[model samples]
Target: MPPGITTLAADAPTLSAANTGFMLICSALVMLMTPALAFFYGGMVRVKSTLNMLMMSFISLGIVTILWVLYGFSLTFGTDAGSVIGWSQDFLGLSGIGVNELWDGTTIPVYVFAVFQLMFAVLTPALISGALADRVKFTSWALFITLWVTVVYFPVAHWVWGSGGWLAELGVIDFAGGTAVHINAGAAALGVIVVIGKRVGFKKDPMRPHSLPLVMLGAALLWFGWFGFNAGSWLGNDDGVGAVMFVNTQVATAAAMLAWLGYEKLRHGSFTTLGAASGAVAGLVAITPAGGAVSPLGAIAVGAVAGVVCAMAVGLKYKLGYDDSLDVVGVHLVGGVIGSLLVGFFATGGVQSDAKGLFYGGGLDQLGKQAVGVFAVLAYSLVVSAVLALLVDRTLGMRVDEDDEISGIDQVEHAETAYDFSGAGGGAAPRATASAPGTPAAPTNKKVDA
Candidate 1:
């Protein structure tokens, strides 16, 4: 080695190793969102299905995690031909993905990117399960998720985020899967709700959540993990990663929280904790797409509007009779659209790398592009998700038998209860069945702290 040559940078091995470590950590952070999601969905349901609801997120951790490593990543991020889907050039195995490989000139192991993106792929569909809770068969759900991921999720992920996809080619700027994750999942939830129909006692019964604090706990965890989810989209420790994502996340979330609470007080005459938690999530969803492309103030504007709009949207389901159990359509889908479109008008200097927003004197070209991108994604997701739901219904069947649904799926499906206070009762009090034709019993007063 010549003295002036500086050892030629160790053949890219050192840099690749460092970036791989950072990505691996980011993957772990994203994985935390599943359990966080468990609490979020779990707390929204009645007590009978608390454990069952939480298990939905947990099952994705088991199922999607393994599947992604096998062929999911290949189908998604593999080399593309014409941007429809990736070729099987790396199929059935992660062949040719080595430490020296580079994605966009960064010296990171391609496998690291594969795994981190896999975490996102795993959690996206799980977010929709909340909308069809307490009714559908678990077996049918597992089948639906499997097919949905393969057909709807993988192809759309490729179109939006993978290399050379049409959306990417069209200059659509989705910093962290606003269309791929949220809009796709939200739309899918609507499709499933249509197929499965409503819960037995949906509108007539109170159906209030058994635990509010649990919901708040889940929201907090999601808030914590989202920092990694949004910022980590940079795919490396880049110059703007910290500044752009950090302030965008905080400011938007804060504004949404305030907006939601304010609207609730005005409309409902009371500010419920549930509203606060939901508002925070609404803000988070709105900020996701624009996090890396909008100024801090722009993020706040986007989030505030999202919080108000989504809060109102929650009522639309009731008025329309769709039975979106957990408001996935209201929050994620609506919020996603708001964020994806607003960024085109709010993007500023250095955020978009050769693009500016309407406020910054960039004109309506960017906003038009953003609208085109949003509509394309929304239409594609709706058609694909509808097909997936129908397939699940026709083949294995999508919903449970009436008796099973009436009996509460926790015992019939998973063979477990979310709570067992009978042991403490000294065999004195009789255990209540979940579907006793009355309101489901709340769990024992013993509460888990948020």
Candidate 2:
């Protein structure tokens, strides 16, 4: 155990087999979300940039995992230095932690808890990649994730979740990470997009996804992994709060999917698969911060509102002239705000009786607190992320050149492609003759037996 840390007394049951197992499983589930997100964002961009899109998320797992174990955990969860940030060096590399030492309020090992939160650290910045897709330099993005996580994500996480952090002391109610994760990443995306500028053809090109099936598959994985993301946040199975959160997550996602489809039919005259997947994600984001506090009915309200509002919000990029290629700003920023704020109004004294919402007779007090947390994170993340992106842009460069953007970021940055259409997958598509890079393919007119 660390010098000042406390744990369950040795006389009492020190470890619960069930809770440890549950947390381990939950950690694994959250780990899968990064790759799941890679697929989710991967299938949304044009095929030329798909591999690069996947890499943007995949690289976070490598970068942030190292940083987290080194000092990230210490800065976010260590003893408070000034009520704004945790001890920056105490838990470096998680040193001085014992395998049997238990985390407070639970029987699980501290290692289990540390790794679980590490997964959140990994996924948060990857969430921003979708907005800047098709245009960023992979090296610059990697560097930005390093600096941003250190400066922005780590300190904000401390403020929201650490014991003496101001937000935790101020009655903020982020059961999960409406403030730290979603809102942080979403607002950061907007900041970077301002500097990254538009893709080659902001609204002029028909940049339809190359594969809807891939998008659907990725969404399915995200839905599966989110159970652990939202529910396992409780850190123990003994509390019934996890169960309520689980059910709320499901219902809210289902409601959001339907709401999005309905909005599409009313506005565009057709229901689309993309709408269904995006709506489900919108619902997932909406319930993440509120699920532990709201009743099932409240969840339905939140999901429906997010589905409709986010469906409308995605169009803002076009009208406002900022290009968010994958709608991260709309889905995450808008959905996160909806979830965080609605908790102020929909909280039903579910988790804590004193945390009732306005309709529950708690009045507008909680609503105002929620607004403070939401906008505080929004403003801080937006400003810091923009400064980081701009600094990286000036020093190391940020966006790829126009030619690379047009041809394909996959080959330009990563030296690979997502698909090889030259009959590589047991198909009979003709292989092009070696010639100039942009030459048209020769057609075959030879007769062949059926």
Candidate 3:
């Protein structure tokens, strides 16, 4: 996130116990986000698909951790290879680095940095699960994560954060992961959904969320954990840049939530719980890349804009005839682009770097640079992820059979359902019914709320 310290003190870099401890706590906070996301996404799908939705997010923790230890860290943070990737023999298997050896230019150990970054790697793939919920095969989704991270995530992480990375060298300002994580995952979600096709009876079914409380709980946890996610990206608090990021994160999220609720009230005539949770997330994504560089007031503008924009963008799937199950492309992809590009207008040139935004008299140069970073990651992740999804679909089969999907993906894929009603009736388990009241008995060409 912070990449590396840009300016060193007079003394040579040495280990700081304070920084190491702080980073360890931050890593744990970030690790909690994947499961929190599981709950958030899990509650948004039909009851029959709840467990499948949760598993899609949870599995990334297991898959990415093993991969990160083996080669993820090396390729992401190792020595630059042609400004496209990284390589380091010592970082292989994480076997060669000493406990006391610090990440270059920082006080924390290389292990600390690696683990911190690993949490990001794990969460990015999990973010895509929301888009493909209720229809994908469990094993096939696992296979996709395995191949996608190896082919797409790892190299992109290097390009954005690694030493001598082309984007970093070009002076693009991404304090966190607006490009590498959110846009990368959002674009991938678009690609996969394009190949996998829509869920059965997508627009015809009401498909209301089965558990709003779970979604709220998940959103609360994500908000708490995101403090660590944003502030800790600065690596340390010695110079107080992390503190500024912390404050900006809170300000922007609050603004986004309020803005989203307002928009929902105006457009839909009701402020739904889903809108609040989504707005909070939109704010979080919008401020991630710009927090360190923008003022607190600037964060509010960014969050408010992203909240209204993403709230409106979520309806595009319906208008365009693409079924993004949980609005991944709308929220993450659009929010990430807002945050990354706004840096060109809001960057103060006093906190993270000397480059000023257009609003600050730096002209259109930085904005142009930001656009290159955003679109490059978008195009690459979109094209590559589509190819990978197609490969998986053609071989292992990405979507379940139409009948299985109609019945329930959870029971078909995992033999478990989110809710069991056998004890209530002393009979076989009850099939999942539409949770929302007054849902139609049969599919119809009725308009459904997004």
Per-residue lDDT of 372-428 in model 1, one digit per residue for the tens?
878887887777777777887898887777787777778877889888887785755
TM-score, model 1 to reference: 0.90
Judging by lDDT against the true structure, name the best candidate: 3
Each model's lDDT comes to 0.83, 0.92, 0.94
Preferred candidate (TM-score higher): 1 or 3: 3
Cα lDDT of candidate 1 equals: 0.83
Runs with alpha carbons beyond 4 Å of true place in candidate 3:
1-10, 424-450
Q: In model 1, which runs have C-alpha deviations exceeding 4 angstroms? A: 1-18, 425-450
1-450 in candidate 2: lDDT tens per residue?
569876555655478889999999988999999999999899998999999999999999999999998999999999997888887454799987887888876789989999999999999999999999899999999999999999999999999988789888888888778889999999999999998899998788998888888899999999999999999999988869898999999999999999999999999999998999999999999999899999999999999999999999999998999999999999999999999999889999857346989988889988998999999999999999999999999999999999999999999999999988777577576665686788776767968999
TM agreement with the true structure for every prediction: 0.90, 0.92, 0.92
In model 3, the Cα lDDT at residue 63 comes to 99
